[model samples]
Target: MEKREWKVCVTGGGSFIGSYLVNKLLQKGYIVHATLRSLKDAKTGILRGFPEAKEKLVLFEADLYSPHQFEAAIQGCDFVFHVATPLNHEPGSSQYKNTVEAALAGSKTIFMSCLRSGTVKRLIYTASVLSSSPLKEDGTAFKDFVDETCWTPLNDSLSYVYHDDHHKDYTYSKTLTEKEMLSYNNNENGCGGLEVVTIPCGLIGGDTIQSFASGSIAVCLSLITGNSETYKSLKFLESLLGKVPLVHIDDVCEAHIFCMENSSMKGRFLCASSYVSIAEIAGYYIQHYPEFNVKQEYVEGKKVDVKWGSTKLCEKGFVYKYDTKKILDDTIECARRIGYL
Candidate 1:
């Protein structure tokens, strides 16, 4: 199909990844029905200013809780990029039960809307790599590597009892949401045509629209910012997954496009170009950005490497544009440019 003839719907169009995807789609000549919680957002302004956006892009107001609200956005679109996820981001905001309920319910509604949208041929979902690992039922680490086959165990033993409340919730959110989204493909009822492709990306950080300092970027820059709490979370994740799996936001956006354009792709594909330790990250900062006080303590020399970043996407011909150094460089540059540095 010609790119110009395709009407694509991108949920969470104002989000870190969604805005970039919106811009990429516009540049590629795809008519985008970009959905946000509100029409009058700062990100929407930037989106509207993109070249050809005036003619090719349309904005719609939608929220996860209301399934009907998504209908207008997905209405005649040939493809859907289901990126908007329910996340509090702030620490200690609510009870864990509420968080899980909201995540699963919102995710189900979005998937159901996509299935209900008869015109949608494919739905490219943004799954998180955090959804994997805690491999054993007894809360152990991954001995070999992580991949699409490795799902995070959520049955009370590990993930549910994780010490960090926020971490536990986020992991379960992605794991449960992914399982729910992919399960619809086997629907025996009248709703089974929507092809679902999940690109589970690790820590996403890179160029971002102004005023939108993403949580991923913040996590990546925790060492620089001296945010011990966020840095602790990263270390815990590293110990649990046994690797510093990460990828630039641009690569993530590119993967989304690649999954949508290529017809043969299916199931889940994990994305990450960098797998280094906190010491490795600190080393880079110490060399190039010595002016800032980079936390040297992260070089604890207790690193655990794992093979979580799957090469499945590359095997299917998708190439990455950024490495660990480049991912850090772009993330730092973008963060500085946006005054978040």
Candidate 2:
């Protein structure tokens, strides 16, 4: 289909990454329909980033579990970016069941609706690094990188302990949800059989383009604002310092656009800038905001062990302009540019 005629719909348009995606699509001159849970919410300053987008961006109140709602949302859309997912982390959180069921059901619903409607030519699903790796094993992430194929396949004994009470449910949901998405063995062009592209992304970092941040921006801000209880203190510091892969939010958006533009790309794409150690991140922070106590102990002048990998995307010509140094530099630069510094 022609770029100008492409009518795109992004689920979770008010969200962090989704907002960016919507804005980018609109900037490229494509008609966009964005989904919100309610018209009231959308009218109440939900889509403030692109006020002009109100004309091109249609707000549809849709529920993930309700197949009918999704069917209505994707009507007449040429591409679907299924980016919405439940993110609650409470241990007894009943939201997990709803979240998982909704994601699985919502994907099927969107894909099926797209195929049946015969409108969408491609569909991109917003997946996560955790979906690929559960982190169920109690090992320090002491490595440098993690790739698309490297998923955390913990046995029954491991899923319970790999994560904490806060995020255990969330991690498990992502792992199972990704698996469920992959399990669909539909042939191309089947009803709901448009190309399914999975983006396994690492920790997203960026400032809020809007007053309200969603997805990785929220997570990064939480870490920055010390709201993330999981990555605080010495133990958390050591654990985090062990290993992680990092990506700037803008790059991730660009990747989504890139994949959409390049129709031949299929299967799993591990979106990351580079493998970064938490200690290295801490060092970067120390260079500027020294007051943030990213507590760590120096034993023999060495840091702890942590590991992640990213090779598949690299092989696919997704060049990372930012390494650890570049990431920190760009982050600080972005902060300065946006006056966060």
Q: When superposed on Cα atoms, how far off is each prediction in RMSD?
A: 2.8, 4.3
TM-score of each: 0.92, 0.80
**The 10-residue segment with the lowest total lDDT in model 2:** 232-241
Best by lDDT: 1
lDDT of 2 by residue, 1-341 (tens): 68778888888887778777888888888788888766677432646547567667777787564546867778888788888776642245454354555566667677778777788767777787765542325642423435565566545454333346435555556667666565543564443546777787777775446554334443443335555453433223234334456787777887887777775656778787766555556656666666655444311225534455556666766666556565555555555565554
- What lDDT is reached at residue 173 by model 2? 62
